[model samples]
Target: MPTTPLLSKYPEFGRARVYLFGLTAGCVTGVDFVASSMIGIAGAHIQGGVNAAPEEYLWAITVYAAAAVVANLVLGRIGTRITFRRYVLLSLLVFCTGALLCASANNISELVLARAVQGLGGGGLFAAARIIAQLVSEPNERLPIFVGFGLGSFTLTALAPWVSAELALSLGWRAIFLVQALVTVPLFAMVLTLFPRRREAPTTAQMGTLGWPAALAFGFGALLLLHGIEDFRLARIGLSGGETLALIVGAGLLAFALHWLHRHPDPWLDLRRLGSRRYLVGLGFYSLYYLISGGWNYLMPQFLQGGLGFNFQTTGMVLSLAGVVGLVGVMAHTFNFRRVFRRRRVIVIGFAVFAVAAALMSISAMPGASIAVLMPPMMLQSLTTALIMVQVASMTYLDFEPEDFVHAYQLKNIMREIATALGTGMTSQWLQTDRAIARNDLVGRINTFDLQTLAPELPRTSEVLARLSLQIDQQATLIACDHLFITLAGICIAAAGVVLYQRALA
Candidate 1:
């Protein structure tokens, strides 16, 4: 069937049209923020309330991210066949239903399953929103729409932790899902009514090229990779059996999957686009940006709530400032600083600032440090996130032809999902290992036999010992957080140097 002009179906470009476009942007951006950030805010609840171990808690994030990676790659092509409107509506239904399932989940396993379901819909929302943006705005006029989307998305993300904290505290974590379900209902109605209807039937070629095999292979490979990481972490710490076998198995599977994708005539993802040097470098920077940002977001909540003894509301408020700063940074892009600086320069500056922010965060991880000490670094990190995210994305797609734009978007989304999962997983693994080491070192220093030592001052009662043990655990966690931040800072600084060196070589 012939393609329909999807853009022509909407009302004229005016206030009403802008409002609809804005709503679609908000929905797409909001779902991702809420889904990604909630894992951090609710990390404690999921671990303690659900009795899940640290590694197990990671599944809540990994499963969702992995599902999203697959969905983003597959759904775009599927949209071409089913029509954007029908595909979006179906996705919304799936999203809402998943939220309901999440709200009713009684265990971690159920919650993880529901999250996967939700990710499928969330991925569609992201792709559909981009499609709508493409259809509604001319290329020249699209920048403002993107800025507006960034502002709205970050604003929603900024408020999400506070809202999630309030709900989790007042009504329990399940309320977060309930609220998501309720909010999506009206959005669903709006989408159904306002979105353009499909007029064209899919061609035989479109119907036959679903790429399910590639998507399945990709997802399974990602899962195995994460599972292998988990096993490695456990084995290194002597917490479980060695993961060499799992690692080998996962590498083999991933290799097989890549080979399959390369051989497929119409692959879900066009790997050929990665051949561009600019695209590859930008892709590298983008992945690193998410690696740092995602890990920090996940780790910060644990530090504040678990290590520093902050209440949920207080932690939410503190972290929410980053969102506010992020909004400001997004707005800063409107000034067209790119006119004065090369994209490479802007990227290097962003990463440099990120490194500084990470260093500040490391210093703030000391025991008994005030919340005030953490605020500046957090805000700076958020600012740099907005800067790097927008610029790197623009640079990545800057040279692509119109035909390659879709593939570029797909590849970016896939990298983003994988990067986020790796960030959260790696940070969690590092924290778990570092904390164990710190705790052991602290315990070893206690020297109960030495009457002159600090341990002799404490009473020998079980209550006293328990309290002292808790204090030690808290301090150990703080030290571990410090180590993680310093490592992240080193990574950012090194990345900045690499970017600069690449510019020189170019």
Candidate 2:
């Protein structure tokens, strides 16, 4: 908990101090990696296997995301009322409690309730980290802090799958949550000992309260709308009458939530910041980047393990290689993002590489392909995402007021969370739908009656169709996945255009 001598004695630390600050940022990011990936375990647990319905399992992700959105909005306001140090420590406590609860959960529903608690903590960890970085450093020193946070997130993300797998195997998935709880203790202690508290605005009650009704309504509304969008895609392909009705209801709730937000005096989130040209453009790029990036995160595991049938270790190795490459790329650009690449140019180029990596992923799923053949493309993809993340976030707040940093940072996190939820959720659904349609279509064309009537004769049509079904399903899933990459690419390109327009305005 002791402050580095440099930070205590100097208003702005030197290079060593800055790097240490980055390391601190990374530690905070580690918390996020643990929380974010825990949901995957929750989903896997509920389905009782890896192959559980991707659509049904998606709520594990969406619910966590919904929690984050509420946290970002709510915590941003809460932080304004207290010291950054106190807020972070409190947030960590909430997170640790959630982790412990998740570890002890008896069922998926309990696990999700635990995750909602975890999400509250997880969301605060990210937003609070950004806010703390802003407070600790001078303007010129922020990039290093941002870099440190990025390195931490990417490293944990890269390592988490392998680590989670091991823990899940040896100790059960619950152990992952327990480990997070243990890790937070030292972090919590460090904050209390070192970080000095500061005065802030009035209490929440004095700041014109956002009541529970408005808060829950706003949260549920956003969740339902997002759920509707996710469910709509599934409904288009398959789903019974009940499922379709659920989707419609979700959409309606989302609409009502928006109307409520418009009418309410004390809505939980401040949507006014979203009106800024810079904030909008920045969020646009962030959402696009994550949409593309999230697709890779969600599908790559399936590509590595499900399609190629690589063992867990092998799949982890493949992703680990990409993560290492991404870390190197981020470190290489750490000192000078503005100097090395213009923001607009970096995003465009990054998206181009991401698209290429995504395309190669589809090819990697081709029958009989070795994963080693796909490593180069995956590394390139990781490198691109690494660069884009830091650059865009730093640029997003480039010209904003100091007071606006929390708002901008929270919005950035919200967009990334939602984009990941939507992208991963929708794509997983697409894969399932495509496979089902292919399987049913292949079955329909087979002459089961003729094969039965023929008795001992070779069931040529059935035999061919069985093999054909597997091939068609696999191929269709890959093709649909490939198209998603192209769609993400187009989204990124549009984001680039928005950033360019904002740049012109600047």
Each candidate structure's TM-score, on Cα atoms with residue i matched to residue i, is 0.90, 0.83
Whole-model lDDT per candidate: 0.75, 0.67
Deviation in Å, model 1, residue 366 alpha carbon: 1.7
Any idea what lDDT model 1 has?
A: 0.75
Report lDDT (Cα) of residue 276, candidate 1: 77
Error of 1 at 83 (Å): 2.5
In lDDT terms, which candidate is top? 1
Model 1 error, position 230 (Å) = 4.8
lDDT of 2 by residue, 1-506 (tens): 74434343354456665655566656776787667754552335435632335555666677778887777767766776666666788888988998898788776677668778887887767777778777766675566566766676667766776766667667766777898898889877756654445535566553545445555555676676666666666537576677667667656655666676677675545565456666677677778777767666777766655555566666666777777888788777775555765666776677667766666665565666786688888888888855577666666676677666776777788788788778777767766666567557655765767446644455567776575555656655555555665665566556555556557223
Clashes of each: 0, 0
List the lowest-lDDT window of 10 residues for candidate 2.
2-11
